[model samples]
Target: VLVIAIIAGAAYYMVAVQPFQRVILSVGDDSVKTGYFLKRMVASQGMTADSVLQSLTAELIIRQQAAAMGFPAVTAQDISDYLRNIAKGENETISDADYDKWFQERLDTTGLTAQEFNKVIEGEILAQNVQDTIGAQVNPQVPQAHVWIIVLDTQENAVSAKARIDGGESFDAVAKEVSLDTTSKENGGDMGWQVPELFSTQISSVIDTLDIGKCSDPVAFSQQDSTTGTTATSYLLLMVSEKSAAMQATDAQLSQLKYKAFLDWLSAQEASTEIVFHGLNGS
Candidate 1:
């Protein structure tokens, strides 16, 4: 009877363990590899190999965090909303089944029960709430500016160009004739309503110091060519067309603000956490 029991156990491992192991291995090496990669993450130079057990623990922690923050638990509706937001953000069509299949595979690999996974989701939602709170504190009604930008290849060239403009040459004609940014040159360098953050520090500072309809001295900025990773020097000539007064936050805008604030907060939290890793295989 003992021998028979041993044989049964061996069979169980053969039928279950091997397949699961292969799935986990394949996921680590290929497309469905979130679980595998997660395990490989090191905390302070130590290995934290992904395991169903770790996932379960993480989920529990997330739940505790949520509860502590007075956030509601995650629900099916929450998941649906999250999925919709993801689809909109990615500009892709994804179905509920897609989310379910992806998460179910993750849960299977991480050994997290559905309830445990929900807890993790709940924690995430709660964390988002904290982010929302921070975002609400930001003054989203900050004014946007309509301006023109003249990009150049060098600082000397930008300075020369600015000299010409200040000497009474037409900004539009000079920009069209000399500016390297062909797209904007044709429009007389008009870059429509943009927030201060969108411009480089030099350009933003210059714009802040100028009145509307005032042209700035050529301010140096850097641009990277995405294809070749080449760094190019550029100059901006800004003309602030309009500046609006601060306005109240819209719900959609508030959500975006909150999301960004949350990310900043999360980064800070992660930086502060005491984390350590050991036995990093590759390292």
Candidate 2:
């Protein structure tokens, strides 16, 4: 009986506990074990499992790319400095004893050991470092397009609107009469100076490529119907009235572009990197 019990326990460990230590997410050669992902799910209160997985994936990619980009390494001292800044009084850093007490409380609340929590802090540091580095590259002046749009409920309407503009009818008059977009329609379809990143994927793809004063063909956009849970497609006709090679970006536009730059880099990394998901759904 004793021998049988020991064998059964060992089998259970192999089936259950061992799998948690196995890699579940991989980016290049870097990986996150299932155990670490679960721990993060616990630490990240109220986040869904899928969201936790995404956060870990982003963190791994950031750490990997940061190293390749020659960004400064995060150290134990750096973690301590982060703690000190947070625990500082009006004039001075917290004393060692107080710092210890606060740190212990944090660990107790999060249910993570020092090592795991330090890894979390290191992830935060690396993310902020990357964001700052990317943001600094966004210049105050960037290429922009002065655009007008006519939003219609169907492709036929969009095509007709484009034809009207092509056949010497005033765009502003047609937009005022037929556009479904109330705000732009009220403004004579003027979108003002715009960055492509601020629009939909379809619109952005053609916005920079269209010649000045030329109208685009119908561009389709899809949205889900909230009441009936069905997808509905709409169409838009775009005309680039002017283009600027170096238009000044507003603070809001700069912030948006900076964030987009980070996402774009991450997307490129994901495309080039060999990322594999394993052991999910018991496979």
lDDT of 1: 0.61
Count steric clashes of candidate 1.
Answer: 6
**Candidate RMSDs in order:** 9.2, 4.3
Q: How close is every model to the real structure, measured as TM-score?
A: 0.55, 0.76
Tens digits of per-residue lDDT for model 1, 1-283: 9999999999998775544343222211122233333433421134334454244333334344446667766678896576466544565766667777766775666566666555455656665666666666777776567778788877788888888888888778778888788778998888676666434567767776678876787676777897676997677777787776564455665555566666566555445543223222211
Task: State each candidate's clash count.
Answer: 6, 0
Q: In candidate 1, where is summed lDDT lowest over 10 consecutive residues?
A: 23-32
Q: What is the C-alpha lDDT of each candidate?
A: 0.61, 0.86
CA lDDT for candidate 2 = 0.86
Best by lDDT: 2
**TM-score of candidate 1 on Cα atoms, chains taken together:** 0.55
Off by over 4 Å in 2: 1-5, 39-52, 75-118, 197-201, 223-231, 281-283
Residue 232, candidate 1: alpha-carbon lDDT:
78
